[model samples]
Target: MPTHTDQVPETPRRRPPLGPEHRWVILGVGVAAQASFSAMFSGIPVTAITMRADYGLSTGELGLVLGCTALGVAASDIVWGLLTDRFGDRRILLTGLISTGALLVLMSLAVVPTGDGRPPMPLLAAGLLLAGVLGGSVNGSSGRAVMTWFREGQRGLAMSIRQTAIPVGGAVGVALLPWLAASHGFRPVYAVLAAFCLVTAVATWKWLHEPDDAPQGGGGTAGEPVRERSPLRSREVWRLALASALLSVPQMAVLTFAAIFLHDAEHAGAVAGPLVVLVGQLGGGAARVWSGRYTDRHGNRRGYFRTVGALSGVVIACAAGLTLAGAPVLLTASALAAGGVLANAWHGVAYTEIATMAGARRAGAALGLEGTTLFTVGFVVPLAIPVLLEQSSWSVVWAVAALAPLLGVPLAPGRRP
Candidate 1:
């Protein structure tokens, strides 16, 4: 037996049988995990109306539901990362899927606004917070598995495809859950998502493998795995954080309220609400894969990040403008453009860069930190935007979102020290 101190081969030491690649199988499991986790988040937009109708919740209260989830996502990332780093990815991933699935079912079946005719705000808030925390697991443990399995140049494409699971799950939620809730009520939505999550959790546990090549020594790979110390420990981390923060605000803002903004501010009709979200998600899913491939080929992410950041800002501004213009034809296109470019595109590269920057050994922590920052924005933006909109018009609300990408401009290639 090889000593724990011995180095593993860089490539798969014992290759799988030809004509049926195991890598694709692993990717499938990862995608399924992400899809299941996404179902947990996807319910927000799809079920918001139902929640409001049932509870007679105000905008601030509704925003709190979304914010609490983001708070859960932000707060739990480090814990998930540490767990993935300590336990094997397969175990953590399975655990996340199971716990999240159980919670999703609980959420679907939970009866809020109980007793004496008052809504159960605290109970509902608690559930949403719990769901968000569980949802964060999707990106951490499974993401670590994907990063560990894929080679450097291939990470972008692999991660992007994995990222696609989000939209695929979201699209499913958008198309099915809302309709189910509208017709059969929320129980069906919970039952369907829970069943899907459990099935995927079982499949992931049974089939997912840490790549044979995962950098290992006897004790297991833990902490920063990069050859050099993390650029994150230096000023670069702050720079990256700033860029990530700026872009995150707009990204989350739109996600939290795109449908609401369209329906209430622009009068786009109720049917268009979830459809717009689906379009953005689908566009983002495709862009994530494309951007990953692009980053893999380029070898450096600076230009790609800078370009996407700028373009996202531009797209957001255009969308906001078109939205305010009240022109039906242009509004949908611009909205989709923002969703495609800003919402999902930048993340594929950003996360890929985080994985690569940390190297295989430390990728988990890097991703953990990255997710923490991103979801923190997720927590803040939902609550913040509603407050912003409270005193002002939707245009002011969106303009604030549009400025997010600009904050990243200082982090572009030449600007960073």
Candidate 2:
């Protein structure tokens, strides 16, 4: 008879723990993936002038076209989130990036203007809508992947770093796309954006991955009952999602229209408009990073989120007042910067809270739901802004936006929830 050791099957060797370098690697890949999609979506506003000139579109028409992308995103965000939950982040992200890039290329080919200089608005809108559908994959997949890699204590910082990609990508798009559209035309801008998506797709395929030991459905501790298996059923999740969606109103308002406001209302120069947007984005990115760090150390995610929202309300209220009073350009710009920074700073923390509430297994779905709500807001807000501007002044618009964040304060999750 064989001894116990000789008769027993050999245990499979465990994979080595991720090294220090791996953390940064994951963070870099996540940031890159998020940034590519962010640039594509946020870049739309930068091309408004070019599109208006080439396609003979009015401000309302252009706003409608831009809003189409958000509608697409809202429609698909939850589906992509569910996909990430089922198929894993790597596959979903790669599929999204590659397919979205291909669609962008198709849009460049199929949606151009004719001899009459009138583009088929419906077709262009459809293309952007389709692109938004594909582009929705980035946020959930990238966020889930980062969550798997980072420990709970470090998640706020990691997610914040990932979130910073939005403003960073937007800043780049705002800085580069306008000039490209002015000099080279819309087709080149589309092609360049497609190239970025493709390149990032390749990079993500190479570098992005979930932890080997990650759990499915609910990231549970050993022997712990799965707490967030049905994230949609949880009332807390709904509350948080609602608050996030409401808070996004002001942020999107500034992002989509700040440059136009600066140029048209404030009479700031062309260069000054984009420059201010770029600076605001930089400030927003920094605030996100700082907020993430603060939340991680303080361990009060909800409080931090509420505090940021309240502060955003104050800043935007002040900005509305300044704009209405015809304050100096410097004062108006400062208010915009402060509002943008505070409004945007809460995103990472809010996402972290969602992920925490849902657990790892269900985080994709939770994030997807939140994204869906926020993108729905994004879709509606742009369309509404034009109508608001038509009916009222920029001051009226800003004043209304200021109220959005304040509305979110009461909805912010509590420590237990």
Local accuracy by lDDT, each model: 0.72, 0.83
Whose TM-score is greatest here? 2
| Model 2 quality (TM-score) | 0.92
* lDDT at 282, model 1: 80
Model 2: CA > 4 A from native: 1-21, 114-116, 216-225
lDDT of 1 by residue, 1-417 (tens): 779779776774764542325668778898998887677576565567766676778888888876887789789986777667667678778877888789877766664333445447777788778877876776777777777666666778988898888877777777787787677766677678788889999898778877554456411223434454643474565567557767766667666677677667667666666776777678888888888888788665767777778777777777667657755744644664454445677777787777666666556667777788887887888788888887987767767777778777666334223
Q: Using alpha carbons, what is the TM-score of model 1?
A: 0.87
lDDT of 1 at 35: 86
What are the per-residue Cα lDDT tens digits for candidate 2 across 1-417? 788878868799955675545867878988998888888777777677677788777788788888887888899988888888888888999999999999889877767765656667777788888888999998888887777677778989999999999889988888888898788777877888899899998888777655545565433223323553578888989999999988888788877788778878888866666666677677889999998899899899999888889889889899899999999977887787778778778899988889878877777888898889988988888788899999999988989989998998899778863
lDDT of 2 at 58: 78
RMSD of each: 6.3, 4.5
Model 2 poorest 10 in a row by lDDT: 216-225
